[model samples]
Target chain A: MINLKHTKMKNELIKPQGLVKNANRRQFLRMGTMTVAGAGLLLIGCNNDDDMVPAMPGMVSLGTGDIGILNYAYALEQLEAAFYAEVIKGSYFANASAEEKTIMGDLEKHERAHREFFKAALGTNAIGALEVDFSSIDFSSRTSVLGAAKTFEDLGVAAYNGAGQFLESADLLLIAGKIVSVEARHAAAIRDLINPGSADFAGDDIIDSNGLERTLNFTQVLTAASTYVKTEIDFSQLPS
Target chain B: MNLIKLLDTICPDTKSAEDRDRFYSRRDAFRQFGDFGKKVALAAVPLSILNSIPHVAKADTASLIGVLNYALTLEHLEYRYYQMGLDSGVIEAPDRVIFQKIRDHELAHVRFLQEVIGNVLNGTPVAEPGFDFTAGGNFTPFSDYPTFLALSQAFEDTGVRAYKGQAANVKESDVVLTAALSIHSVEARHASMVRRLRTKKGLDTVKGWITNGSIGSLPAATTAIYAGEENLSHGGVNVANLTGIDAAAVSEGWDEPLDMNQVLGIASLFLAN
Candidate 1:
């Protein structure tokens, strides 16, 4: 096996963030022996690096704790950002209004901003950007763009709502709470654009009889999300 | 703040035996704490202020009840706001369905919270206090569609912030925390929907999210609901660090939470004197 020390050091310099500069891999042993198990279980390294893979491959487990949860959130944001970024690359269909185009641009900026926020906050513990396959979405069609936006937005909101239970740190919880509302707002706007009426904004199908939005666990969310993403996300390791 | 009485008033017809027993036991548990139980309903510490204090989530059922009651109070105001609007026979012909949908959710939220907080009401649970969305002599929100929309926007925005403000307080209980956030996002969707309706009618120019102190002027009394929603910081990161990200754009990026006291300060305005 390649020397873990040499490979980690090499990867460290390559991914140095202008902000959120944290990488515990170099200090893994000293850190691991002294630190409480899973206290800061944000251990991260490439799986197929040939030198040393810090995490398991074949399917990436979002891990089992707060760090895992944050990484899980980061993965979703990446998919959303990539989707919006792609939507903007195509010309507006004839039926797409100026307002709709502007809204799409605004949403693109918001999703990209969210994507970067999670990436920076998680530091090196963050996963490398996963490949996204938005092939199923036809960016040029108004119906297609808004429909996919609605799905991602609603999914993002529900995912955060469900994932809040797993967050151990209140600070992380607050961040998730703040972002979830943005997703909710996005969902409403997309729904309105699709159907253009007050009734559609808070539609019945997505909300339950008690008025709560739909919820999905990590696995369920990954199931729907991975359809648009090329990456194989596995939540088998996430703890109850 | 007798929570049971308050629940009874807001939901006077609430005839659930399960709820009655739950509130009674919670009261019994609080009686286990004597006078401290009574104070818990009014003693909820806001999450922002809670940073300096230690979290005793495991040992303190009193604090948990305090947080739950705070949520319940806000739900009371929202349900009544919609209930009155629906009854006024003034909702635009096309929009009653939308308002009805929101009212149903608020009512559900009130019930959901009552159960989550122990499904119990105590001390008359603080009566449903009167609501005058127009603040006694102001514009008649219930009679005018524009005024009604403005008030709805205020209440929903306040609900979103109020829900967020309690996350830290409930973090100790995963079940309650998850449920609270679920409602929080729903409230935000309501806010965005109201804002969209207003924009559709040319009543305002607002984004789905509150942008840079851009909450349009409604009643002077309702100002506090949108107060501080312009904040651009998240945890420790400042949005200023990002390219092309300003405070205005940042404001839309993350919705800020309002402390319990601040929420009450606004809800109290609509209370029938």
Candidate 2:
């Protein structure tokens, strides 16, 4: 019922074939073969591509289980990190105040770190690089840029709030909690920047009268992401 | 003979033989009889009847994870809404910085959930598409600053309520739950900002804090505001369930859970047909 088969397929795609079976034996042999000659040879053979080779494609697919949910968060991080990177690379707003520039720069750095953190944790299982289409944005204008920024910040907070329940691993959930809290802080900061005294930016839109948050399935989110993303995402494994 | 009758006819004989045979002698007979019994049982069932039953789809876990997905969808919609506003040349220069930061944060949130999904499932699911926040051009168009501010206020307010409604689903996971609550607060902050912006511009938007009278019912003055509004619905979903939450308590410190149906309906406002 949980679509174990779909999860299994995702697992098979993420992990290199035979890694599980030969892990122990390979470790033993590697330890024994860690000689000075081997070390020198390895150093000489190491290539930059090995470190920077983009993670395998589709490794971020969160199969229908809980881990699938975490991957969803990771993929978003990839997009944010990339967006900030581009923003920093091209400071589009000519009139951007020094303070605004600094804050934006700091945010970019933070997003990058968050992205790398997820990538490291996910290893070869991380998702492929995503292509974001921001053509609709007029980066040259402060108004257009900030408008998009507000949307991103507010949406980030809401998304995290809605998806927090699916985490099964306490450790992973703890890390997510830490990261999302920071994102919330960022959201508040953005809100205030847009309008002073708007520190309490959230309202009935995000939370209901019952004091509870909303939950969404993968289908709902993918529908929204389809606009900016060029690559086709296969969420078929997600629980319907 | 019908399958039931044939089984009934054969069953008695088998039972009689089984009862009459002595213990040692009846062992082989019993084995044969047992095999026959199994065959009869299978033969008596109709394959066509079994095939006719529809296979039910398994229910997904409506836990914190489900709730987060719901939030993620909302965030995506908001992100797009603001993007459209900024891109369409409707916002003023002063407001541009404000919306930019908000957009950045929304993207961060989208990324955050993507991370969560990846971490939880160890892979990224395909992102969904086809969201139309304008609702097929039915609601107040966000063509100008006033309309944009008002619409943004509605979107932000809805986001707050939606987050409050789904809090319980994630309570089981303390870490995720706490993070979600924190995000909920941030969404609240965004809503308040939008409301203040609207109020400043002479729009009679509700205050940041909901009053007792605001609970359980739409204010008489604003009823017409959303009536027959197409933007209120998301993918054929309705917002009726959203009224179930105690709006008075919304101003209180505690986070309120939104009705799933209501959240889905609000989400539909941005859903692409």
CA RMSD (A), model 1: 11.5
Candidate 2: segments with Cα more than 4 A from true spot: A1-60, A91-94, A210-215, B1-273
After superposing candidate 1 on the true structure, give the runs of residues whose Cα lies further than 4 Å from its correct spot: A1-61, A93-95, B1-59, B118-126
Q: What tens-digit string does per-residue lDDT give for candidate 1 at B1-273? A: 233222222221235666545545544444454445532332242222212222223234556678878888888888988998999987988888888989999988877666545433221133356677777777688789899999899889999989999999977656567668878988999999998788888988877888866667566666677778777666556655754666676678788888888888878777777
Q: Kindly list the per-residue Cα lDDT of model 1 for residues A93-186, writing each as its tens digit.
A: 3356777776777777777777777777666555667878778888887778888999999999989988887777787788888889988998
Scoring only the A-chain of each prediction against the true A-chain gives TM-scores of 0.75, 0.68
Quote the positional error of residue A78 for candidate 1 in Å.
Answer: 0.8
lDDT of 2: 0.49
TM-score for candidate 1, please give it. Answer: 0.77
The CA lDDT of each predicted structure is 0.70, 0.49
